[model samples]
Target chain A: MDRVRVVGRRILCGILLSAWVLLPASGWGAPLAPLPAPKAQKPAQAELGRRLFFDPRMSGDGGISCATCHMPAKGWGDGQALSAGYPGSKYFRNAQTLLNAAYNKRVFWDGRLSGADLPTLVRDHLTEAHFMLVDGRLFPERLKQVPAYVKMFKEAYGGEPSFGGSLKAISAFLHTIASRNVPFDKFLKGDKKAISAEAQKGLALFRGKAGCAACHNGALLSDGGFHALGVPENEQIFQDPLRHITFRRFNKVIGVPNFMNLRADPGLYVVTKEEGDRGKFRTPTLREVAKTAPYMHNGALATLEDVVAFYDKGGGSGPNKSPRLKPLGLSADERNALVAFLKSLSGEAVSAKEPKIPDYEIRKLGDN
Target chain B: MDRVRVVGRRILCGILLSAWVLLPASGWGAPLAPLPAPKAQKPAQAELGRRLFFDPRMSGDGGISCATCHMPAKGWGDGQALSAGYPGSKYFRNAQTLLNAAYNKRVFWDGRLSGADLPTLVRDHLTEAHFMLVDGRLFPERLKQVPAYVKMFKEAYGGEPSFGGSLKAISAFLHTIASRNVPFDKFLKGDKKAISAEAQKGLALFRGKAGCAACHNGALLSDGGFHALGVPENEQIFQDPLRHITFRRFNKVIGVPNFMNLRADPGLYVVTKEEGDRGKFRTPTLREVAKTAPYMHNGALATLEDVVAFYDKGGGSGPNKSPRLKPLGLSADERNALVAFLKSLSGEAVSAKEPKIPDYEIRKLGDN
Candidate 1:
C-alpha cells in the first residue's frame, strides 16, 4: 500500500502495454497453412476435358463455353458484378474463379453443389436452361457425329461418348487447375524475406487484431463453412427480368417456400430450406484474392481495399450476421499491410490453351 | 309494253334461272387441277432426308424433331389449336399440315418464307426461338459427329455434313410427299362415280355461289395469295404468360411498330412492314384440310362446320377482311355436302417409319 509499491505496479503495466502495441505477431506458422502441391491428372481425360471446356458446342446455343465466364486472364472470373448467363439470361451471383477450384470441394457461392461429385455439377450447368441447356438424350447423338470426339471419348472412358463420360472428362480437366509457385508457399517452407516487410506486417494484423484467420484460415484459406456476413444484395438480380426469372425458377426448382414473394437470394436456404440458413453463403477461399477483382458472393466489393474496409467496419448489418464478424480497429498502415499479404498468396496466373475442335466429315456409305 | 310481252320476258328469265340451278357443274377441271405425280427422289438422298426429319437432334434441346409437330398420324399437323413451341415457350399460331407442303410454294401462314427456297424456310423453322431454336453454327458440328449422318450426307449431297446440303436433301424428300389416291383426283381423271353425288353438288357450289374458287383454286387448292378473313384470336395467346412472352418477342423481332402495344398477331405484315398488310395471312392450301382440325391461321375455327359457319356469317369482323369472303347462305345440307367434298381431297394419311438413330463410338486418339 506504500508509494514505492504503487510506482512498481504502474511501470509493469506500461511494459505490458508497449509490448502489445509495438511488437509484431509472427507470420511463420500456426493457424494459417499453405496450400499443398498440385495433384497429378490423367493426360487423356484431362485433354478431352480441355477440348470440351473451350468448345461452345457444350452450350444450348453453342455460343458460350466454360471459358466464357471463367476466363483465365481475369483470374478465372468474368470480372463483372454479376455473371453472364445463357444467351437470354443474366446471372444473380458473381462467378467464382477456378484457379484453385479443385482445392475447394464445396463449389458455388451458396454451396448448393459439391465438387466431389463433379460430373453432377457439370451436368447441372450443362442442362439448366439458364446455362448450357443441353438435352441429355441428344448430346450423345451429337458426339457420335464427330469422329475426333468419338476417338477421344473412347480413349478417355474406354467406351463410347456417354454423357457421364463427357462430364467426368471435364471434371478431370478441372482437377488440373491449381495455384502455382505462390510466394506464401515458399515463405511457409522457411524462406525468409519471400514476402515484403510491409506484407509481413499485414500478415501479423491478419492473424491477430483483424481476426481474419478465424474464418479465412487453413491451407485453402477457408474453413469450408457457411456464414452470414450481412453482405448487401446487388439489386441487379431483381431489376433485370431475365435474372429475376432465373432466380425465381431456381428457387422453385429447389422447392423453396413462398418463392413468389422471396426477393433477395435465399443463399444456403435454397439447399437446406431452413429459415435460419437464409442469406448465408460459403466462406470463399482467399488464395488468389488479388487477381479476382470485385470480391464477395455478389461482387459488391470492387477492390481489395474495399473488402478490407468492409471487415474493418464490422461488416454489414443483419439479424443473422456472423458473430465472428466484429470491428477491427486498425491504423491505415496495418490495413495496407494486410492487403499486401493477400497479394503474396497468388503466384503466376494459371492458364491453358484451347484445343483444336475437329471438323465433321462425310464419306460415301460403306466406302470407308 | 303489253301484258303478254311482259309474261314472255319472265318466261325467258325463268328458263335461264332453271338452267343454272338444275344441271351440275362439270367435275372435269379448269380452275381446279389434279396434283401432278409425286416427283422421283434419289433413293439415297430421300432416305437421308427421312432420317433427318425424324431425328430430334434437329432441335436445340434435341427433344423436338421436325416430325414432333408434323406427325403423320395427325395428317402432318400437330392437331393443336396453338402450337407447342420450345420447352419454355408457346406458339401463338396453329401448326400447318406438311402433307402437301411441297406444292405450297409460299410456306407459313404469313408466307414470309418460300418453299421454293426450302433451305431458307427450313432454316427459319429450325433457328427461330419459338420453333426449334437450333444454333446454326453448332448444328453442323453436331451433324459431323454422327458417322451415320456423315455417310448419308455424302451419298445424298456428295459432300460433308454442310448446312446447305442437309437442307437440300430434306427438300428433295419433301418433293416426294404428294397426295396419293385422292378421290377428287380420280374424279378429275374421268371416273364419274369417284365422288358422291352430294360432293359433286358441293363442287358446283364451291365454284359458283360459294365463290371459294376465287381464292381456293389451282392444283394445290390455294391461290398462293394473302387475304384477311378476320379469324378470331385464340385467347390462349394472352391467358398464358409463356405464349404472351413469345408473342411479344416475336413481334419485336419482326419489327412491328409499337410492338409493346400490339396484342394480336400482325401476320403477313411481319414480312411487308406495311400497315395495310396487317392481319393478312396467306390463303392456305385445302388439300389436307380434313386432317388439320381447328382450321384457319389462328385455328379459331375448331371444325369444318365452324369454318363453314364463319364463311356463312361473312367471316369475322376486321378492317382488313377480304371482299371475297361473303355469306353463301348455305343450308345445313349444303354445308354437309361441302364438308364431304373437302374429305375427297385427302387420301390415306402419309407417314414414314422413324430410322434408327446412330450411337456415339469413341476410339483412343489413334486406336481403331
Candidate 2:
C-alpha cells in the first residue's frame, strides 16, 4: 500500500509538468500566451539590434530597410497585406510582425519554419526570402558595398569579417520586440476596472460562447498551434514548388486566384504536403493586429469587423476543415467592443528621427 | 519745530515707498517687473491656442502648414535660410522662431510689425505675409470648399458661423509657444550639473568677454530693441521701388526656378523705408536660434560657426553697422563649445503627427 501511494505521487507530478509545457503551445485552441516580465537590465545586444533594425543600411538599395517593412509605428508590420518588395517587386504574403517572436517555437504562417534562434532566422530572411532582393540582385552582394553596415557588423561582432556579424546583430535586436502593457494584461492582474464595460462583455463572450479564448488565450494572443480552418486550397502549390515548399507538407493545394483578380493564397498547404494538413495555418497573435489592416492570410478583409464576421460565419466550406469551425452569433455591440479592446492594445511607441548616414569611402571589390 | 519734523518723516516714508516701486522692472529688466511668479496654472486658452497652432487648416494650402516653416523637429524652423513661400511665391526674410515671442514688444527683423497681442500677428501671417496660396489664391477661400472647417471653426470659437472665425483663437495658440525647458533653465533652477563643463565655460565667455548678454539678455534673450549688425544694405531699397517691390515682397519671381537662387530681399528697409533702417533689424531672441539655422536676417550664414565667425570679424563691415559689431579672437574649441551651449537651449517641442486634421467634409462657401 505504501509503494502504491509513492507511484501515484510520481504520476501526479509528471502530469502537472506536462500540462505546464502544453499551456503556451496549445490550450485547447487558444493562441494568446502571457509575456514574461521585462528585465530591468538593459542588454547591449538588444540595443545593437534595435539600431540595426532602424538603420536602412541593412537593405541593398537603401530604399527598403528593415524598418520599412517591420515598422514599429505600424505594429512591427507594414500596413500593407504584402510589403512592396526590394525597390518595387511585389511580394505574395503579408509582412509578418516580429512582436514577441522570441517566444515562438515555429515562425511564419505554415510552421515549415521553426526554432527561436535569431541568427539562423535573420540569415534566412535576408538571403533565402524572395522579398528582400536589392537592385535586381540578392542582399548579400549589395550589403557588401555599404560601409556603415561593415562598421556596424564589426562593432556588433568584434569586427568579424563575415555576414554572420549582421545576422547576430539583427537577431539581438528582435529579442526586444516585446508587447507593451495592455488593458487586458492589467485586467488579469486584478484591476477589475482596467477594461471598459463593453470590452468586459466581449471578453466574456470570447471566453464563453464565441470560444475565441480557446484559440486566442494568454498574453501574446496565440496558441502557437496550427488549425485546418476550411480555407480554399491554391493550385499554385504544385506549379511553384519553391514557394509552396512549406504548404505542400500539409498535402494541400495553394489557393487559386479569386474572380476579382486577387491572388488566392494557399494558407498553409504549401508547407506540410499532407492531405489532412491542407488549409492548416498557425494562429496569429492578435496584439496590435488592428493597425495592420487588410487582415487574414491574404489580406482579403479590409476591416477587423470583416474578420470577426468571417469567423462568425464558419469560414469557407473547403476540404479538410477543422471540426472547431462553427457559426458564432454575436451582436453588433459585442463586435464593436471587441474591436475597441483590440485597438487599446496599441500604445505610444518610441520614435526618433532617422539618423543621417555618415559618408564613407568603400574599396572596390577587386581593390582588396 | 514739531510740524517740520512730522513733515520730514512723512516725506522720508514716501521716498522709501517710491524707491521700492521703481526698483524691480527698471534695475532688473522686465523679468523682475513685480509680476506673479511663473505659475503652473494650465491655461485653457493656451491649450486651445496650442491646438490651433498645430492645425494645418490655418494655412492657405493644406500642405504649407505652420509646421512647414517653424518645424518642431528641426529646431523650430525648417532647416533652410528662408522658408519656401506658399505654392509659388518668394520669401524675403529667414523664418523667425516663435519662442518667447510673448515677451517681445517688437516683432520681425525690421521691428516694424510689433503688437502687444498674438492674434493680429497670426492673422497677418495667414492672410497677407507670405501665406500659402493655391493657384495664386488665398487658402481661406480654398478652405471654404471643405465643410470640415466650418465645424472646426464653430467648435473652436463661440461666434455665429463665418468663413474666417476668430483670429484671437490663433493668438491663444501662439501664446503657448514658449521656449523648452533647456539645460540652462535647469542650471538656473540650481542643477549645476545639468550643463556640461564645456557649456559652462562657453556661458562665462558669452556673459563676460563676448558681451552677448548686453543685447541678448533677460529671460526672452532680447531687450526688445533693434540694431544694425552691418549686414549688406539691399541695392533695390535705394534704387528702384516698383522693380524692388517684387524683390521686397512675395512674388512669382522667387518661386520660379529653384527657390534657393539669388533672393530679392529688402530686409528692414521694407518696414521703415529709411536709409538708416536698411540694415537695422530687430535683436531677435536667441532662445532656440541654434535650431533655426541660416542665421542673420537674410540667412547669409549656414551655421552657428559662421554666425560666431561673423560676430568675431565685427560682422560684414558696411554702412549703418552697429557699434557693437567688433572682432573677437577665440580658439576653435571655444567656438565649438559656444555652439554646443546654444544647441542646449532647444526645449521640448510638439510632434508633427499628433495634430492632423480629422476626416471632415468640406463646407460650402455660401452656407455662412
Candidate 3:
C-alpha cells in the first residue's frame, strides 16, 4: 500500500511538472519588478517577535493570538469572509493579507496608520474591542509571570518585559516577511515567458482596457491610496447582532455621526471623518492574490472573477463611489485572462512553523 | 522634631498602660478552650502556593489577586463593607476573611462547598463571574507562557502548568494562613492575666445572658452551622447597577427562580435550593474579629457595638429568621464589655510581604 501511494504521488508530480510552463530565459519584458526586500531586522528581536506573534496569552482571554487572524499558512490572512473576532464578539471586516506588508507606507484598509510604525498597528489590533480586547495595563504583567519572556525581553531590548518592547519585537518580525521569488519578478528580470501568453494579454488589459493600472501600478501593484470602489456590504454585519454591535461600537468610538443607524461601514471616513471619504478604502497590494480569498474591505467578492465582474459592471452603489469606475464591457475570455494574470502575481507559500509555547514556573521560593 | 515625637509617643503609651485592664493571676475560669493548630503542609508546595497567592496575573484581568480582597493587614479580609471585585464588575457581599479558613469544615458564605477540598473553593473564587472571572481553559495557557509558573508548578505538583495544579497551589498557601496568638487563647491556656476583667464579664454574658455562645462557639468561634440572623441587605446592591447586574447574573446562573427581580441575596438557598433556606447563611469564624470591621454577610453592622445592639433588639426581618434571636436588654456598660471581649479574640497581624513577581523571557528560539 505504501509503495502504491508513493508511486501515485510521483506520477501526479510527473504530470504537474510536464504541465508547468517553462519560460524563455533570454527575452525579458515584464511590466513590473519584484517588491524591494524588507528592511533587515535584529536577529534577537525578530526571534522574540516571531514567538510572540503566535502567543495567545497577550490577549484578554488568552484564547486569541495575533496568528489567530494573520495566519501564515493562509497568506497571512484568515480564510474567512469576515474575521472570526475575539471570544464573545464578531468582526465586520475581512482579514487583510500581511504578506509584503513591510513595504506598505500605510496600513489597514483605511490607511489611518503608518506601516513604518508597525508597533502601533499591532497595538491597535491587540487592544481593539472586536479584536484581542487586551487591557494594556494588565498585559505586561501577563508577560512578567512567564520567566521565558523576561529573558527574551532582556536579550532583545536590554529591558524587562514591557508592552512597547513586545510590540516592537513583533514589528521586527514583520520585517522578515515579504514577497519572495515569483514569475512576475523573473519576467521583469529579463525572462520573456515567465508568465503564460493568456496572462500577458490579461496584463495588457489591466494596464490599458480595464484601467486597473490607474491605482494598482507599483512593484507592490498598489498606489497606497484610498478609493471609493463601491464594494457591496456583507449582509452578515446587519444580520448578526454581535457584528452589528461591534460595528456601531467602532463607529461610535470614532465619533461617527448617527453611529447607531449607520448601516454601512464608513471605511476611510473612520480617519478623515469627512462625508467625501465615506466608503473609500486603501488600494491593497496584489501580491499573493491567489492565496487570499473572499477579497475586499467587507469581503463582498468571493473570487477574482467576481471582483473583475464588479468592475466590468461599473461597481456597486455607494455615497461617494469613485468616478474612475466605469463599465468595462469585457468579453468572457478577457475576464478569465484578467483573473489568470492576477493569479500570476502570487508566489509559493511563505510560512513558518508555530513555536512551542513555554509553561509558567515558580521562579524561586522568594521571587514570585 | 524626632526627639519630641518619640517623647510624645512614649507618654501616650504610658497613659494607655495605666488605663489598660489587669486581671487576677490565680482565677482560671473561661468559657471556651484554645483552637488546635492548623495541620502542617509540605514546605515546597506551601512556598509555591504563598507566591501564587500574591500573583495577580492568575486573575482574569491581572488586576485582582487572592490578596486583593483577602488582605493580611486587614485580618486577611479587605476592610470594605463590600469587596472591590475584579475589574468591570462589583461584588455584592462583604469580603470574607481568610484567617482560620483552614479550620472551617465548610466554606463560602452559603457553605456550598467543603473546606477540606480547598482547590474547589479557590476555583470558585477565581472563575466565578462576579469575582476573578478567569477562564480556566485559558489560564493554564497563561501559566504555560510564564516561565516562573512552569517551575513552580513542577516544584509543587511535579507537572506542567495546569488549571487544577494552580488552584491546588493557591489552596496550599491557604493552609499556611491561620489565627495566631490572641488574649482569649492565652487565657484558655490558664494565663488569667491575659484578658481583662471586663472581657471576663463579657465572656459570662456570652455563654449566659447574651446567648452568643449558642452559635459563636468552638476553636474558630463558629458552630459550623447555618442560620438566618436577618441581616439587612446592603443598599449598594440596589444603588449600583454594576453590583445589581452581578447579583442578578449570579442568581440566574445558580438556577434561582425569579432571579432578575430578587433584589436580596438568597444566602443558603443558593446551595439547598429550598425555600426554607432563604436568608440563611453559614456562620463565619470570628478569630480576627477586631480587624475585620463592617461585619455580617452584607456588612449592615459597622462595629461590634452595632452588632451587639442588633442582637440586643432581636435580628432584622427575613423570610426564615432564626427563633434564637431575641432582645438581650443589655445596658450600655454590658455592650462595652461584650465589645472588649470580642476584641480579645484577635491577635497580632498575620502577614507575608508580596513576593517579587518575575518577568517573562523568550526561552530557546525553537521552543515558544
Candidate 4:
C-alpha cells in the first residue's frame, strides 16, 4: 500500500508539472487565507471583542493598533519590513500575519512568554510595563481611563476573583482566528479537481521526499518550534541595521546574544540563553506565508523559492545549524514540485475591516 | 377647483390627525432620518475628500474635523446639545444636519458665503484666517505635511491655478452629495399613492393654512433665505462655533462688510448688514429633518410636534423678529397635518463609510 501510494504521488507530480508549465504566472502567487469555522462563542462576548478591536482608544498612542499591523485587506500583515510603533518607531520584528494566531501555542518569535490569552495582550499593550509608548503619551491612558471601557470590561469579563477584563475578552476574539481551509485542503478532502494537478504533485513531494513534514506539519503546517536551516549568512545581503544575534558559547549551549546582533535576529536563543540555540528561529506556520513576502525571521529570503532552494541545498553552512538543515538535492522538477507545495499552503482570504478611530479620539490623538 | 382643493386639504388634515393618534409614541422622540441606500463608489477624489472630512489633521490641533459635527449615521449632525470644540467648547447653536446641503444655494444659518463650494469650505477651515481651527491646537500640521497628501491632492485636483489638494478634492466630492428622491417627491411626480393619504392632506395644509411653503418650498423645501420667527433670546447663542456662518457687513457700493451688529447673527445681514436682518436665521431645508431632531438652530425642540406647536404659537417672543411671524392658531389636527407633511420631506438615506487611514499613519501616531 505504501509503495502504491508513493507511485501515485509521483504520478500526481508529473501530471502537475505539465499543467503548471501551461498555466499563467498569476496562478502561482499567494492564494487567499482560508476562512476558519466560526467559533461557538457567546454573541455578547464576540460583539464586545469586535467593538474593542475596532476601537482606536485601545492602543497606546491612540493611533498604533492591531489593525494597523494585521490589516485584513493586506492579508493580516502590514506590507512592510517592520511595523511602526508610537511616534513612528521602526519596530525590530516584522508584524507576523494574524491569520491563524489562535492556533499558536506560543506567541511572538522568542517564545519567552506563553499562555498570553487575548484580553491580557490587549490590556498589556495599554499598560505602562508591556508597552511603554502609552506611558507618557496622552492617548492610550485616556482610553484606559474612560468610563465606557471600565463598564465594558466589567460586562465582558465580570470583575472579581478570577477575571480582571484581560485575556478572557481577547482570547474570545482570537478564537475566531483559525486557518481557513484552502483549495489544497479542499483537494485533500476528495475534491480532487479543486486544485490543479501541479498542486497535487507538490503536495506529494511535501508529504514525501521533500521532507517538509519534518518541521511544518498538521493543519497549520507548523510545529511551532525553532530550527537553524543553513541559508545564506545573514550579514551577506541585507544591511544589519539592528544587530539581533551574538554567540555566547560554542557547542555546549550555543545561544544568540540578546544585545542586538547585526547579522541575524537572535530569535529564541536570547530567551533560553543556551549555546546550541544560536541562529535557531521559530518555525512559522506556512499558512499564509505567500502573501507575507520577504520570508525568514529577518525577512532575508525574498521568495518561497529562496526558502525552498535553501532547504533543497540543506540550509546555509553554520556550526550550530540543525542536522535537519542538510540539502535535499532536488532536481529542477522536484524543486518546482516543492514550490508548488508551498503555494498550496496559502489559505482562504479573510475579510478585514479598516480601522476607524472616533473623531473625538482623533481630536485627542492629534493625528490625521 | 380652488374650493375643491381647499376641501381636500381639510380632509387630508383630518386623516393626518387620525394617523398621528394611531402611530405609537415609540417614534415620537426618536430621530427619523432617511432610510439607507445601496451603492458603492470608488471615485478617488470623493474618497480623498471623505478622508479629509474625517481627518483631524486638517484642523489646527490636528483634532477638530468636519465629521466631528456632521456625523453620518446620526443624521449628519452630532447628536449633542451643542457641538464641542477646542478645549471642550459648548457651542450655543446646534450642529445643523447636512442632510441635503448639495441642493442648497446658500450655506449656514446667517448665509454669509456662497459659491465657494465644499472644497473651498475645507480650505477655509484649513487656512490661518476665518474659522481656522487648525491654528487653535485642535489639529496639528503634521497631517498636511505628509508626502501622500501632496500626491493625492495633485491627482484629485490639477495643481497650482486650481488650488489643488484637499480643497479641490473635497469640492469635487460635495458634488456627489445630492439628496435621494423621497416618497413625497415620488408622489409629487404623479404617483398619487406613493405617500399615505394623510401625508397628501398634510402637504396641502403645509401649502395653505399652515403657510410653511412661504419659506420651505421647491425641491429642497427651502428658499435659502432668512426670517426671524421668534426664537428664545439668549446672549450665549451669538457665536457659531462651526463657523458655518460669519457676520459680514456690506456697503451696497463697496460690496463688503460696511456695518455689522455685534449682538446679531443677522442671517443675510452678514452681507447687507441691514437692521431688518437682525436675528433672522436662514430658512433650513425641511428634507430629512425628521432624522435630525432637536429642531431649529439651537436644537431646543425635541420633536416635530414640538416644532409645529412652536410655529403655531409663532415663536418664542423676541425683539427684531420677522413681521411675517404671528400665531397661526392651528388646530391640533392641522398641527398634526403639518408634522406629517414635514415627515414626508424625509428623503432617501445616503450611504456613509468610515474613513480608513493607511497603517503606516496609524502606527506613526502611536500604539493606541
Q: What's each prediction's TM-score?
A: 0.53, 0.41, 0.53, 0.41
Model 4 over residues A188-297: C-alpha lDDT tens digits? Answer: 45567877777778766765677676667644677678787644544421232111100111111233333312244456667777767766777788876788876766
Model 4 / residue B208 / CA error / Å: 76
Q: Which runs in model 1 stand beyond 4 Å of their true positions?
A: A1-368, B1-30, B363-368
How accurate locally, in lDDT, is each candidate? Answer: 0.75, 0.55, 0.78, 0.55
Q: Model 1, range A1-368, lDDT digits (tens) per residue?
A: 44376457645644544422222233422246556544456899999999888877666555678889888888888999888887655678898888778766578888988866778888988877667775554455345546788788879888867778889898888888888888886776567578999888888788788988777776777878888988888887766655665675577667888765765778888888888889899888898889999999998899999999999999997647888789988789988999999999998878888667665442112321
Best by lDDT: 3
Q: Which pairs clash inside model 1?
A: A144-B145, A144-B146, A145-B144, A145-B145, A145-B146, A146-B145, A150-B362, A151-B363, A202-A337
Superposed by TM-score, candidate 4 places the C-alpha of residue A59 at a distance from the truth, in angstroms, of 3.2
Cα displacement (angstroms), candidate 1, residue A25, comes to: 19
Taking the tens digit of each residue's C-alpha lDDT, what string does model 4 give over B183-253? 77566545778777778788777766666776666546676777887766434443331221121211212
Residue B147, model 3, lDDT: 82
Cα shift from native, residue A138, model 2 (Å): 8.7
Worst 10 residues of 4 chain A by lDDT: A243-252
Following a full C-alpha superposition, what root-mean-square deviation does model 2 have from the true structure? 24.9
lDDT of 2 by residue, B49-153 (tens): 555556564543244566677777776667766555543233546778765565577787766566565566666676542453211122333333335444555
Q: Which whole-number lDDT from 0 to 100 does residue B164 have in model 3?
A: 86
Give candidate 2 regions above 4 Å deviation: A1-33, A38-43, A55-57, A60-62, A134-154, A230-264, A350-353, A363-368, B1-368
Candidate 1 TM-score over all chains jointly: 0.53
Q: Candidate 3 deviates by what RMSD? A: 21.3
Q: Against the true structure, what is every candidate's RMSD?
A: 23.3, 24.9, 21.3, 22.8
